[model samples]
Every structure is written in C-alpha cells, then in structure tokens.
Target: MNALFPALRTRTDLPALRFGAETLTYEDLGRAAGALVTPILGAGRVAVWATPTAATAVGVVAALLAGVPAIPINPRTGERELAHILGDSMPGAVLAGADDVLPAGLADVPRIDVETAVDHHSPVSAASAFSGAEPDDPESPALIVYTSGTTGPPKGVVLSHRAIAASLDALEEAWAWTEDDVLVHALPLFHVHGLILGILGPLRRGGSVRHLGAFSVEGVARELGAGGGTMLFGVPTMYHRIADALGDDPALVRALGGARLLVSGSAALPVHDHERITAATGRTVIERYGMTETLMNTGVPVGSRPRPGSVGLPLRDVELRLVEEDGTELRAYDGESVGEIQVKGPNLFTAYLNRPDATAAAFDGDWFRTGDMAVREPDGYVRIVGRKATDLIKSGGYKIGAGEIENALLEHPAVLEAAVTGAPDPDLGERIVAWVVPADAEKPPTAGELADHVAGLLAPHKRPRTVHFLRALPRNDMGKLLKKALPEALHG
Candidate 1:
C-alpha cells in the first residue's frame, strides 16, 4: 500500500547509487526512473538485463514504479538456460542498457534502452509522477525470480510487493539499518541476495550503495578505507579470498576492520575462513540464511556476539520449526537433532509461475517446506546441515550432515576446498565421501590422513569413507557448490 522506496519521492543531492565510476544522486535516479514509467506501464511483464550497471538498476526501478512485475535475466546465463527463462516468463519487452548487444534469445523481443530513456532536461517530480498516482495492491506480483534448476527446469518464483516489504522491514530490525549507512558489495544482480537485499534493501532504507562492479581486494580496501562505505555484503568465496589476502594486505584488514557490518550469504561460510578473517580483522562476518522462494528467514542480530557455523536466530515475525521425515514437528532444540526446516512468514513467494501443482505441493497449510536440514540450538541459533536431498547422509543407522563433514575437512591445513556427499554403500547404508581440492599438488594429503583428521574433529562414524582429490570443486556463479556436477567416475 505504501511506496517501496520513499527516498525516490523527495529531490535530494545525496548519492543514491554508485556503480564503478558512475554515481547517481537521488534526484537524478528519480528523474530517470520516472521518465520511463509510461513506456513500462501496461506492459504485462518486463525482462531486465541484470548486468552490474547503473542502467540495469534504473530499468528495474522503472518497472517497479509502473507496477509491473520485473523478471531479471542473468547476463552470463547459458543459451539454453536463457531461452528457458525467456520462454517461461514471456515478457512483453526487454529493458537493457543502450550499449548492450543482446543474445539471439532476446533478439525478437522489443528492447527499451534505459540509458536513452532518461529525461534530464525536464523536471519530472517522482512524487507526483510515480508513487502519488495510485496506491498499489500489496498482493500484486512485483518480481518473478527463477530458481537455480539444480533438480529440474528453473521455476519462476512469484514474489509479491507485500513479501518484499516485509523482508526489508524485518532485516531493518535485525541489522539496525538506517539512512545514514552506505552499503557496499560486488554480488551478481540476478539472485535475491544481490537484487533484493543488496540493491532494494538500501533503497528501502533511504541509504546509499556502492557496487564494486566486479569484486576485488583493492576495490574493497579503497572504498571502506576511504570511509566511503560502512557495510559490506559478500558470499563465502569472496570472504575466502579476503581471508587469503588479509595477511599479505594490511590495507584489506584495515578496511574490513573499519566496516560496521560484514555479511555473508548464498552459501555456508566455513568456520576456518571465519576464524582466519576474525583473527586478522576485529570485525566478524555475519552469516544469514535464505532462499529464492523465501527472501530472508534468519540472521544474527546486530550488536550480538557472532557465532561461527550458526545462522543466528529466526528473523522477526518468522516462525521456524524442524520436522521429521514422517511430517511430525520436532520441539527439542538440544542442538544435535537434525530435521527439515519448515517456515511460516510474510516474506514468502506467492507461487511458482504457471505451476499450480508445485505451488500446492510446496506448502503444508500456511507453512512452506524448505527442504533444508538444520539443527537448532536451545538459544534459537540455526546451523544448517545441508539439503534434504544432497546434504543429509544416512550412514550406519545415524543421520549425518554433509556440511559438518565439509566444514571439518576445510579445517585441515592440507585441504583448500571440500564438498561432502554420500554414495551407495553395502555396509554403512550410505558412506560419506569427501571431494577435496588439495593445497599442495605434488604432495597432497593421504586419504587415510584426511579421514583420520575428520574423525578426530567429528565422530568416527561421520568420517569420510572415500576421499577424491581434485584441482578445483565445481561452483555456480554465486560460488555455491554443485554437488550434482561432481565426477561420476568417483561414485562408480
């Protein structure tokens, strides 16, 4: 019912967005976004070329202002995946930068160059031109974000304006976010972590954001060390690189130490990297948990002591519970029992676009089945073990989480990267297997030594029965491990 970005209404000289060397003041952004409302309005849905550019932000904001659902397409998407998304969403037109050369998939679609649409000469009041025209229905579809399609074809997750508003407000409470803060990140613009939280979150708080365009240690140091940024958001891979460079680059440590908050999401942050970063910089990298379907479910509250390997507590107004395989709820939170996480909250997707069956199957009454397995401590801290399908391993009459094994493997001095999964086993029902990237190529750690290392840290039963060496583990654009893409020869 209310405006999503209140800052766009009033004209101000304050910097609203900085992408690389280009900076857009609040007034400049409001005028550019406002000028394109007429072209974007009445379009059923628009596809945005979500590149890390200021034009992409202007296009998405223009679509939102016109009350049309915007579908963001990743620029680096493969031809097949790009075709699938375009065919599924079927947008009326594509909004992209003027200089962008679209692929064959988007060639037939009408294109609106956002850069040329700006009317800098005319003073178009955003308050009167956009938000003041009419109040939007809270249930109206605002965004149609697609899933990763690891299991099947990517399904479009339809998120409502109410859900987005609820998510940002809850995060404001959890992080103590305000207008004075300047956020910084280099995350991609396709997923919720970067698009919803990184971009729109700052807009909602009337704050500023400085995007690195591409992630680099020097960029981070330059921005934060110069006192231009107060907060930082990154994925585990980015933080791992930061930890690796902290010792060599004192400037990097100083910049990170000066930041008010450093947040990591999209994948689990290993405790080894966490300790390494903290030892160098006094700031702790806070971890939060969420999915494409759910904007944000839990985060560590601001001003609280950071807990390694834990995703703090359930966010404000979010009801989270663990459930057994039989669908019964588990109430005991002694921190050892692992179960699938089910959640009920305002910050949830309306449905999978054009898939009624999937929409129905995803929810049990008001709660959504997340398919993530986690253990909850008595104090309400949530430590995600793994996915229900890939991360949970049934071995020797015990349920073992692959994430725990992976975390323990990362602690070894010889292991550079690790991913844990299960293979069919006759004796143990399912044997835990560790796929490792060794720090040393010529003299890698022996399988027996790595297994013993894990057994000493965790229980003996949780130790990997097989260890496969690799130069590098498979990862997606967001640095999330792709367990399904692991070598099949090792399993055979």
Candidate 2:
C-alpha cells in the first residue's frame, strides 16, 4: 500500500539486474527508469514491446512509476493477434527497446524508444515526486495482462497495484524471499511468470536478477555455479530439458543440487522429471499454481518436499475453496474428491478490461471462479487434477482426471511426453485417449503396453482406450499443453 515499492526510495548500489552483457546497479536503474517518466508522462495507458531485454524492464518500470497502465506485447506475437490487442487496449503510446522491430499495428500509436544506459552517480528521488503527488493510487490498474483464451478471444485482465503488492508480499512471506537472494531465469518477459515474478519480484525485494536471454542447460548450470544466482525460476519445459540432461552432465546436477531454490510454473512439471532431477541432484523442484488473473495462489513451502503432481498449499492471505458443478462449495479436504478452484483474496484482478459481462460472470460473490480442477488434502495441500473443460474426462460413470493418467504414463521409461483428452463415444459417453511422444522412436511401445503401465499404477478404467503417437505435444509459449489443439494436431 505504501507506493508498491519502498525499496526504490531506500536501496542503492545493489546489483539491480544483469541481462546478457549489460549490467545495472540500483542507482542506474532508478535513473534509467526516472528518465523514461518524462517521455511517457500523462499517458493513460501504454503498450510495451516486451522483448527479453533491459529496455523492456525499464519501460515497464517507467510506466509503473508514472502510474500509467502498461500492456506488455509479446515480441513474437502474430500480426492478427497484435491487431486485436491494439484495437482493444487503444494505448496512447507504445514503448520498445532501441533495436526492436515492431509490428504494423503499432505504427499509428506514438512510439518511445527506451534507453537502458544513463549516468546516475547519485540516488534517485521517489517516483511520486515527478508527478507532484504523494503516491500512486493502490487500487488503480497497473497492468492489463492478457490470457490465452481457449474458451474465446483473448481478454485483457486488469491488475491493480494493490493486487500486485498483495501477491508479491504473500510470496515473499511464503518463500522467505529476501533481498539477499539473486533470482535467475530465461523465461519470456511478456508473461507474468517472467515479467512480474522473475524481474519485478527481485526489484521489489531490492535484489538482483540474471537473465540468460534464452534457456539452455549450460546457461542454468553456468549461472548458478558462477553467476552467483541463489534462486531459479522456470517453466516445466525448461526444467524438463534440465531433467533430461542431468544424468549426462554433472555440472547441471551440481548446479541444481547446489542452488537454494528451484521453482517451476506455467504448467504442471511431470512427476517423472521431478523424481529424475531429485534422484540425480538431491534437490526437489517446487511447483506453484497461478493464472494471468491471479498472480500466484499456492506454492510448496520453501523447505517442504514437494509432493508429486501437487502444487502444495495456498499462499498467505489467499482464501481458496473447491466447488461442485452446482456452485456449492466443497468444504472437506478429503484429497480424493475433486472440485473447481474458487479463490477470494486481494490477489484477485480488478476486471477484464471493457468486458463487464465477462468480469461479472468471472466471480460468484467475492470468489473468482478459476475453471481449474484440483483435490485438496486434509492438510490443505492441493493436487491439480486438470482444467474442468479440457481435462475432466467423465467416462463410464467415473470422473477420471487426465493428469493422473498422464502422470502414470510418464512413469513408463518409454514415454517421453503424454497428454490425455476425452473423445465422444456412443456407449461410454466419452472415451479416454492418450497422445504420447515415445522416448524411443525406432521401436515405440505399443499402445496396449502403455495402457497396461497406467493400469498397473492406477485403476484399470483410468487407462487410455486408444493411443496416438506424435513427435511432440502442442504447447504455447509458456509451455502449457494445448488440449484444445489436440484435435487439430491429430490430423496434422
């Protein structure tokens, strides 16, 4: 509530960020961000060409300082999607890095090029000082983050400064995240995981961060080993790559094993990868649950051993509940019964920009309907089943979670990647189908053998009725499996 970041007013001389070969001290960042304020002042909303660079970070910070809403545009976004976002947000201006090439949609908007280097041999004044105001309004929208709309067109989710503050505070409390920890990752800067948590999270804590430009096993190993990174953040695909290479490279094993914390998000990290990483390095990767609307809801407490396929407990101040289809709450944490996730807390988004009907429908009373399915243990731990629409396979009078069968299939040594979906059937209502990428291409395991492996681990009914083999599963930029793309991928 006290201006979102108190560290900006007090901290200086700390290593603020390291991106590629560029380095910045806290003072440098303050000045660089402060310089940007005058150029983008009085803009109601601004668009950012969010490339994974120092300029993007500076632009976002500058927008926040000016108390203007910043909408981050993915660099690789298609022109069609870009056009829609531009038409929707109607930003007053667009900010991009010095060397960035923007799409045609942004040609009409005023453009401000970001400069990362600025001499600041002195401390920076409070951001509120520039506007001649006491402080920015906490409830005012700070960012308009977009969701991957599998249900419909992409919608802009407005996040207030208060929401961002609440989430980061809860995360700090839950992870014991201190200013002394140096965060490291190679995630894209457009998304919440990489933009807010990876970059801004460190800045808010008065800590430093190192970005690898792109993810590589070598980068992760080298950074943690000698780059002085203490905490690591990545998506499942990044971790999956590390897990796959851990046995061959002792450096990767030693790097992960020696790091203080390793957190995975953006998708479910396969249980097989978790066990493999832990087996080789003696370190357990932490999994946390969050969406674009909710910054972060739950995480495995820092020191606790992460349960396989579980996202652990709700974060501090986040009130979570599971609900039945009828909208009644499921109060018991019996661990076997599944329900849709409903949340009530300060971490909730303000609105889905310009969509009152969607925003109103998003909440049932004070709780936001998350559309995700999960089972909660008696101890309050959460095991995500899957999404209600895509993953909840109701077949033969049994509610089968595709995630469970996916996990079971991953346990088989021959299986590389597995995704499950339900197909309509005349007799059973829906039949469980498995799409897999085998570890061995020359001689892939038969569908019956994979199904048998699942049956042995779980119930027989949970096994896949049919199998489809592919070279790789379709995924978005953040590594989330695209279940809706399954039908199209099958024919491709």
Candidate 3:
C-alpha cells in the first residue's frame, strides 16, 4: 500500500544514481521521474527502451509511480525478437532517451522522450506530483519482464509490487543491505537482475548505485577503489575477467578486497573462477539463484562463509523443496539426490502475460515449478546442477547434470570454457558430450585426456564421451551460455 521507493520522498539530497560522469541526487531523480508520471498514469501498458542510462531508470520509475505496468525491452534485442515482444505486449507508448533511434517495430507506437518530459516539468516535486495519483496496491502488476525463451517465443513474466518488494526486502535481510551502501555494476537494464535488483534495489533501500556504462576491469577498480561503492554486482563473465585481471592488476585486487559484498548471478560462477578471486582478494563472491518467473529464491547470507558450489539457503519466507519426477517432494538433503526445484513464496510473478495455458502449466497447485534442478545439502544449502529441460541429461541409466560436468571440465587447466550436453548414442541412451573452448587452441587437451580429467574429479559415468573444441562458447548478453545454440554438427 506504501510507495515502493520510500527514500525518493524523504532522502531528497542524497546521491541516488550515477552513470559514468553523470550523477543524480534523490531530489533530482524524484523531480525528473515525477514529471513523467502524469503522462504515464493512464497508459494501459508502457514499453521502455531499456538502455543503461538515467532516462531508462526515470521512465520505469515514472510508470511504477503511476501504477502502470512497464515492460522493459532490451536495447540489443534482434529485430524478430523485438517484433515478437512489441506484438505480444501491445504497449500504448514507447519511452526512450531523447536521442535514441527506435526500430521500425516501435514506429507504430507513440514515443515519449523522457529527457524532454523532465526538462518541461522541472518545477514538479515527486511528492506533490504523486499526491493526486491513485493509491498503491501491492498486488498490482509492476513489471512485465520477458524470459530468454530458448524453447519458444519469450513469455512475459508479470511481476507484482508485492513480489518486487518481497524480493528486495528478503535480500535486504540476507545481504545486510541498507541506505548507506553504494552498489556498482555493468549489467544491462532489461532483465530483473540488472533492472529490478541492481537499480530498483538501491532506490528501495534509499541507497546509491554507480553503473559502469560498460563492463571493464579498470572501471570496476576505479569505482570500488575510489568512488565509494561498497557493493559490486556482476555476472560470471565479468567476474571471470576480474579473476583474470587480478593477477596482473594490484588495484583490482585491492578494490575487490575492500568491498563489503561482491554478488554474482545470471549464471553460475564457475568454481575455478570463484577460487581464483577468493585466493587473490580474500573475498568470496556470493551467488544467488532465481529466474524471471521468481524474483529470487536463494542467496548466501551475509557473514556466512559459502560453500564453493552452493548458492546458499532459501531467503526468509521462501518455501523451497526438491521434487522427484512424479512431483513427489524429496525429504533427504544428503546432497546427492537431484530433483527439480519447486518454490512457494511471495517473491514470485503472478503469471505469464497473455498465456493462460503457460500460466496454468507453470504452477503445480500453489508451488511454481522453477524448471531448475538442484541438490539440497543437509545444512540447507542449494547447489543447482542445471535446468531440468536443457541441463538434465539421462545417459546410460544415470541422470547426469550438465552443470557438474561443465564445472569439472572447467577445472582442467586446458579448458577455458565448457558446456555439457547429451547426444544420442547407439549403445548408451544418451552420452555426455563436452563443448569446450580451450585455453590453448594450438595444443588443446585431447578428448581422452579431458574425459580422464573429469573422471578423476567426478565419477567415471559423468565423464564426457565426446569432446568438441571451439574458439568460444555462445553466450547471451548476461554471460549465460546458450547450450541450445551449440553446433548441430557436434550432436550428430
């Protein structure tokens, strides 16, 4: 019932956002965002060209202030994917920066330049502007974020104010987040991790965020070392770069060593990189697990030393369980039995927008099936193996998780990057296959050697039967590996 960002009203003069050299205090943000609220109030649903800039944040904030559902479209989205999102959401208008060149798909929709709106209404106070607005409702849809849609057209996950607030609050408890903490990151703005948590999380806590226009180790070092950023959030790829750079850059080691928290999400932080960073900086990067359908399910709590492979315990109020194939809940947390993760919590999206069938299928009673597979430890830690649909490989009567094999392959000195999948074999129902980007292309490790490396680390059955070497593994914008996009030739 209360405003999502309470600090916007009370903490008027404190620095709220920073993108490169530009900075906006809480007062500046409120006025700029508040000016756009009137125009966005009655809009059925607004689409934001979610670029990583002040305008994008302002536009989304304005939509939320007016209680209108805001759909964030990724700037780098391909034409076909952009078309699908525009057609699916049917937004009444598109909000973008003053100079942004929009695609033809958005040509039919009305355009709103967020900068011009702010300039035209500089006199408006956020409090005075929102005074006449409709009362806040916790259950109202706040954001409609689209999934990666690896299988089909991306589905819009309808997130409510309740879900967003609960997620942030739960994270506040877990991470010891507060207004004094300054967060820094280079994640894109369209997804929940970057937009909701990276941006909105700070605003909700009345904290500050310093966003690097693009990710660079130098930028990370500068921000944390001198810019007063207490926390850093990034995907594994960015951290991998940091891990690689730490050995050569003392400033980076010092920057990361001094930070209060370093969080990694959007993909698994390979244990190799994790150990590398920790060994260099004496800081363990906290990893959390979630999907667009659920804002957040689990995270490593502050002051707790995390296990190398675990994502930590479920956050406050989130009910999590590992379930068998037949939907039977697994009670043993021995850390070996793998099962699909099913969650019941307030930090969950209401439904898949415009797809009742998908909305219905996503839920098993009150629990939302996360499609992610994991093993639970006796101490309540959750170590995710992979996605049930793509990462779960049934090979030779054993249910093998591609993630564990990928991690094992990464442990080998010759492997720079690795993705594991199953391919059909005449003898075995499916055989474990490893797609590798070798550390040395000219003298790559042989298939037998790599397989033997994995067998030495894990069981023999978990070793790769086939190994394909590549220059690079396919990855999405957030550094998540596109396992489905791997070469068809390798499978054949």
Candidate 4:
C-alpha cells in the first residue's frame, strides 16, 4: 500500500513529462525527487508554491517520499491567506518560489532554496528505506485544501492518502488512462484537479503529462494540434476560451486531430458552449463532477455520446443517491426530480480539518451529503440541477456554481465585492445577474466593462448577463451576505 513512488520508479525509464522546453524522463524526475527529499528528512509537511512545472512536481513527489505531506499553496492567494495556511499547517519546511516571500509568522521555520536542492546530487541516505509510516491516517490529515466560506474565511478540508488515492484510482479506471496516453496539464497544481488528476493520476498509470504554467487557449490549441498531447483537462472556461481562440481556424482544428478525450470539470459546462467546442475543436467535452472533499465521482465515458447538461454515470467504486427534503430516498426516473446528492465510497474525504461539527453535519450516516442538488436519469446518469445552499445558479440547462464565478470575478482589479445569483429569464432558463460593490462606488466599473472582465475570465454561459451595482451587499448580523434577498432584484 505504501512506497508508491518507489514502486513506480522501478518501471522502465521513459519521457514522463514535457514542460516548456524541458523534457524529464521518469528516471531523471525520480532522481531529482530523491535530491529534493534530502532537505526535509523527516515526517511532517512542506508547502509548494509554484505552477505545475517539472521541478515543482519533482519537489512534491520528493516530499512525499520523505514522508512529508506536501501542501500546495495557490500562487494567486493573498499574503494573508498564505500566512494563515502556513501558521495553521505549521510544516517542518517550505519549498517556495524564488521571489515569493515567506509568510510573516513562518520566518522562523526552515526555508530551503529549491534551486539549491535541485542542484545537489540525489541523496542515497533515505532511498535505501523510505518511511513506510502513513503520513495521513484514515482519520489524520494528509492534504489541506482551502475552500471559501460564508464569512469570507477559508476552510481547509483534510483528506487522507487512501481517500485521495482511491479517487485517483477510480478516475484512472473510469477514464481508461494508460501509459500510452499524454495528458495536457493546464490547471493550477494547488487545486485538486491539477494535483490529483493532472499529476497523480497520470503518474500512477505511468502515463506522460505536459505541464503548462497557466491555461492559455492558444497555447493549448497549438500543443494539441501539433500532436503534443492526447488528453486535455480543463474547466468550462478554458474550453470556451479554446473555442474562441480557434474560431474558424482550420489549423487549430487540425491540431487536436489525434486527441481522444477532452475533459471539463470544476464547474458545469454550458450546453451551448459544449456544442460550440465540439463543432470548433472536433472533440466532445467529457464533463465530470467532483469537489475538494471528493476528488472524482463521475465522468462522461469516452466514445459515448455526452448527455446534454449531464455529468454522466458514477464510477465503479462510487455509490450515489438522491434524497428528498425529509431525507426520503429518490430513484432515477426521467432525470427531473431534483434532490440533494449523497455519496459514499473509498474516495470520500475523512473529514474537514479541525472542524468536527462541520464534518458530522455534512453526512447522512456513512454517506457524505454533497451540498449539490442533482437529478438522475433513468439510465443512472446524473445532472446537477443546482447547489443545495449558499451558491446555486441554473442557466440554460447549465448549473453554474457561484463560488467558482465569484473567484473569477475577484480576479479583476476594479471589483471589490461580487456576488452572482440566478435572475429569472424568459429566453435562457435563468440568466446570471451579478451584483457588485465596486472599489469606487461613484466611478464604478461599467456593466459592459464588468461583463467584459468576466467574459475574459469565465466562459460565455458563466458570464453575467446583467451587472447591477450595489453600495453594499445585504448582510446579516454576522456580516454574511443574505443570498435569499438576491432574487428580489430580478423578480421586481
């Protein structure tokens, strides 16, 4: 069960990854990992702050080999959030970017220069006998993924190695990935998608991966069209961007000529955009469903007709159920009965880090009640209708999560506060209406500008159809935005 890297390292040497101009074979990458492990030679944790580059990947694997949990820090995360995570996790050491400063309270902790570590020879000290001890007990914390909370605070979900591995195994089995496959790695490594599916999934199957610093539609299209990779994973936004970038370009279409699968997750893929992408790239978007707590649960099978607005069937090891408001179980009918999605499997997380109450309240017995609301078709395929609470917006057969949209909107400089909610629309099932509190209320960013901002950041379907300015959002005594009052603007 242990010695994952050591077991994989035994395989034949082959080109494992291609990033920028650097090509790292499995043997070379494994040796680099061995070298990096020498810096933090103990069982604790280490934070990685970089994109999904070959060196970063090697450092992460090295930390794991040394029995050190790798905490991937989001490069875009504010300093305050970084400091909070570092203080909370209290890792033994940090492998950070050359220019990125250490968190305030973490100045006392050991910080190994990653470039120096990479330059050193692969240490043979711990390679003889790596720690077989489980860094992440079934109940103990392995990885801490921060999710935005109602109070703007972040909650870290602590998952175990078994849990994450189970999810990756399920994904590998479901997607039918093999060593012959080449995955285009564009998602941020800090997120579950990049860390698990982009890196671990491919590595586990001995498949090759091509890492990108960030998702660039043109870059991806050029790579795919040039026969650079076979498989591509991205959110709906990235796919739409690709579609836009490849508009009427016969060259781009020919570039993705040999790709077998194009995956879309993180958020729902708009039905229109899905069709547009298929028409543009000659590839059907294989949509899937999962969150931070659970790595992967369902995916549209390869070579199968992707059901419109449906995330497709659950994985072999996964179990899914729908329940009414009274906790009444609902079966798959014609895919119209909306209910809360409950899942139970080896892939599910152990618990929320240091939040027993949240963990206990999140489940219905052994099943983890995913806060998402969905309906299952007669064939057992699931279509996410909306979120159970907090963040839910359904538009034109697409169920978009608000958290993802808000995260995108905040990326703009002029945006100070942004909230997305479903506004009733006669044409498109539901139109996304964004209420934003601008940085300067008097000279707020124009609706057209804000729309363009989101358009650049998000997919066509996810962009707010209407932008409404607000002095301040409606908040309760706790200062949490009351989403319940959000619908009034549209209905009135």
Among the numbered candidates, top lDDT falls to 3
Candidate 4: regions farther than 4 A off? 1-3, 97-105, 115-141, 150-152, 390-492
- Give the total clashing residue pairs for model 4: 1
Q: Would you list the C-alpha lDDT of every candidate in the order shown?
A: 0.89, 0.87, 0.90, 0.71
What TM-score, over all chains together, does every model reach?
0.97, 0.97, 0.97, 0.77
Judged by whole-model lDDT over C-alpha atoms, candidate 3 comes out at 0.90
lDDT of 4 at 245: 62
Candidate 3 residues lying further than 4 Å off, grouped into runs, are 116-122, 488-492
In terms of lDDT, model 1 sits at: 0.89
C-alpha lDDT (0 to 100) for residue 444 of candidate 1? 94
Expressed as tens digits, the lDDT of each residue in 231-277 for candidate 4 is 98887667656666667667767666568788888776656567767
What's the ranking of the predictions by lDDT, best on top?
3, 1, 2, 4
- Candidate 3 per-residue C-alpha lDDT over 210-269 given as tens digits, one digit per residue, 9 for 90 to 100: 999899999999999998889999999999999999999999999999999999998899
What C-alpha lDDT, on a 0 to 100 scale, does residue 194 get in candidate 3? 97
Which residue pairs in candidate 4 collide?
225-255
How well is each residue in 74-168 modelled by candidate 2, as lDDT tens digits?
88888888888889999989999889888777889999999888755544444433444314578888899887768887899999888888888
Residue 340 shift from truth in candidate 4, angstroms: 0.9
Scored against the true structure, residue 421 in model 3 reaches a CA lDDT of: 88
